[model samples]
Target: MSHVTPALYATLAEIVPELHVHCVEPWCVIGSAAALLAGADVSVADVDLLVSRADADTLMTLWAERRESVYEPAGAERFRSHFARFRFPGLPVEVMGGLELDQGDGWKPVKARRLTLAGLNGLAVPVPSLDDQIRILESFGREKDVQRAKALRALASSPLRGED
Candidate 1:
C-alpha cells in the first residue's frame, strides 16, 4: 500500500477516536480517502465516512456546532444517506449514514465487504480493502469512479506492491 500523508493522518487522528467512542455500529472511511489509504492513486478533497444511521445522528448531535446546516451533497438521485458535513482542522469530513446506491433494479447498500485497518499513531483506522474499494467505485459507475476503480485494479496487480 502507498504511504499515507501526515496531514491526512493528523486529520484522522483528530476525528477517528471520537467515532470509535460514539459510534456503536460498524463504520469505515470511504471514497477517495479510502482509495488513498488502500494505496490507489487518487486525491481526497475530504474524508467520507460510512456509518449507521444511529451513529450519524450521534455524531451530528455531538458535532452540531461544526455541521454544515445548508449544505446538500451532490448526486441525490444516485445516492441516499442520512448525511451531514462537518468542518475540521485538517479537512472537511462527511458522514454518510446507511448509504445506498440506485442500482436501477433497486437501492443497494454500500458496505465494506472487507475491512482494512490503516494504522495512524497507533490507531487502527478502518478502511475498506483495495478490492472492496474497487468494487464500490465500479458500483457507483460514474466516469470518475470508474477511472479510480481502474487505477485501483492496476495498483492491486502491481508487482512492486505486495498484498496486505
Candidate 2:
C-alpha cells in the first residue's frame, strides 16, 4: 500500500483544480489517493475521473493540447465501453460518464453524479463516499477489486483522526 505524495497532490492541484476535478479512479486520489491521504500506505498507476458528458467533451478538447497521444480505449469492451483514455505528462487519465460493473449474474450501472469534496492536504478534491466506492468495487468482483474493497472497508470503519 502506497499513499499519494504531497508532490503528486500539488501537481493535481495545478493541473485540475478541486473545483474542476471529479475523481472516479479507484487507484487514484479517491481510492488509493484517499487511502494515501488518510495516512494509509498505497499507490496507484494513474488517475480516473468521472465527469459529466459535457465535461468529458470539454476535457477532450482542452486536454488535446497537452495530451501525449490520441485517446484510446482502456481495456475490455465492457470496461472501455464508455471511457475515453489519454495520458498527460506522467499521469494516465480516464474520463467516463458512467460505468457498468459485473455482478456475476449481470452488470450494474454506476451512474455519475455531482461529486462531493474530500479533503486532502488542504485541497477539496471531488470524490465518492467510501461506501459508494466499496459498492462499485464489489460489483466488479475481480480479485483486485475485492482486495480494494476490503481495504476501503477497513478505512471506512476506522475513525477519522480529527473528527469527533
Candidate 3:
C-alpha cells in the first residue's frame, strides 16, 4: 500500500483548507493511502473533491485565477452536468458537482451529502465512509475498482489503527 506523503497532505491542508474534500479516486484512499490511513492497502493518485454547487463555484472562481491551466470548463457541452479540471500550484485538482457516473447500464448522479469530515494529519477533509466507498466503487465495476473495493472491504472489517 502506498501512503499519502507528508508533503502531499501538507499541500492539501494548505490549498483546500475549508472546502469539503473527498478522495473519490483510488490513488489516495483505496490502496496505500487507505491502508496507511485506514489500515488497508490502497492506491491513490490526485485529489478528487466532491463539492456542493456553491463550493464548486467558489473553487472555480478561485482556481480560474490561480490555476496554471484550465483543462475543462465548468459547464462543458460534452458532459451532462457541471465539472471542472485544473492544476492548482502544480497539483492536479478535479472538482465535480452534479456529475453522473457510468453505471454500465446507465448513469447515476454522485450526491454531495455522502461526504463527511475525516481528519488527515489534523486537517478536516470530507470523504465518504468505507461503506459508501465500497458501494461507489462497486457501482463503477471496473476491474481496478473491483480490486479496490475488495481491499477496502478487508480494511473495513478490521479495526482501524489510528487517524491519519
Q: What TM-score would candidate 2 get against the native?
A: 0.70
Worst 10 residues of 2 by lDDT: 22-31
Tens-digit lDDT track of model 3 for 1-164: 13666545755666655453432232122222332344346555555655556666777786786554636543242234455766544345666655566545566675533544556777655556667777766765567668877887887766653332
lDDT of 2 at 116: 47
**Alpha carbon lDDT at 33, candidate 1:** 78
In model 1, how large is the Cα lDDT of residue 4? 68
Tell me the deviation in Å of residue 123 in model 3.
Answer: 0.7
RMSD to the hidden true structure, all candidates: 1.6, 4.7, 5.8
lDDT per residue, candidate 2, 1-164, as tens digits? 12565556655665566325533342223445544444444565556665555566666676766554655654353453345666555556666644555445466556423244566556666566666666666665667667777887777777764331
Residue 143, candidate 2: alpha-carbon lDDT: 75
Clashes of each: 0, 6, 13
Off by over 4 Å in 1: 1-3
Residues 1-45 of candidate 1 have per-residue lDDT tens digits of 337666677678889999989999989998887888777878778
